[model samples]
Target: MSTDDPWRPRLAARARLKFDPVAKQELILFPEAALALNETGAAIVRLCEGARSIDQIVDLLSKNYANADRDALMREVMDFLDTIRVRGLLQ
Candidate 1:
């Protein structure tokens, strides 16, 4: 899917993402593997629920970090999402 399109991103159907209470960490788990995520990555993944568009995600972050550089944040978020999308992480 095109990032420029209004497509909402979601974790792949075969993947699972959540906070692992026992591990005290966030994990992105596939059938045969799992990825540990930093807090920022975890936050981004949590918001990709196939409900909010890219713009909506940006808006949420913008409000959450009033002092952050909006343009930089946008670029970073888009780049990060694109990388994950290419890795078959996003749907």
Candidate 2:
């Protein structure tokens, strides 16, 4: 897939999302590094399972967070996804 494609996002092969029982937090685990995710980050990552498009994720989240502005939420989601992709944690 093109790196620029935002229609569907997927966790990179080396990365996986898991809940750390000890920390009681969501984490993205890769080879030598792990990222702790906030609630919103976790929610977004969970939807990046290679099935849902960026728009779909934003739509679902907008419903779940009814107070959020759709346009702002989209920008935030895109930024988060871009950050993860740059770190080689997302595809």
Candidate 3:
């Protein structure tokens, strides 16, 4: 969410999601650790491929969740991205 590069939300270079056979679930593995992803997070994380911008993501998600409050949805998306970015998940 930088002014210099507003649209692209890139996953950290060392981070990747994989199917954990033992747990029978999806998890994101970063250089530091591994973390499970909920459905919503997986959806959002999959979209953060550095190809789409924040606004683009909002539009797509809003359409997917048409019944939700647009403004609230936007806020939640921003908050989730911010949280993960701070954790070094997103670059």
Q: What's the TM-score of each model vs. the native?
A: 0.86, 0.91, 0.82
Query: What is the RMSD, in Å, between candidate 1 and the native fold over all Cα?
Result: 1.9
True-structure lDDT of candidate 1: 0.84
The residue-by-residue lDDT of candidate 2 on 1-91, one tens digit each, is 3234556989999999999999999999999999999999999999999999888898999999999999899989999998999999987
Candidate 3: misplaced stretches above 4 Å? 1-7, 21-24
Candidate 2: residue pairs that collide: none
Question: Which runs of model 1 end up more than 4 angstroms from their true locations?
Answer: 1-3
Local accuracy of candidate 3 as per-residue lDDT tens digits, 1-91: 5423465887888888787888877778998799798777777887889989887887888888889887787778888888988888888
Of the two candidates 1 and 3, the one with more favorable lDDT, higher being better, is 1
Model 3: per-residue Cα lDDT at residue 2? 47
Candidate 2 wrongly placed segments (more than 4 Å): 1-6
Best by lDDT: 2
Of the two candidates 2 and 3, the one with more favorable lDDT, higher being better, is: 2
- Taking the candidates one at a time, how many backbone clashes does each contain? 0, 0, 1
What is the Cα-based TM-score of model 3?
A: 0.82
Q: Pairing residues by index, what is the TM-score of model 1?
A: 0.86
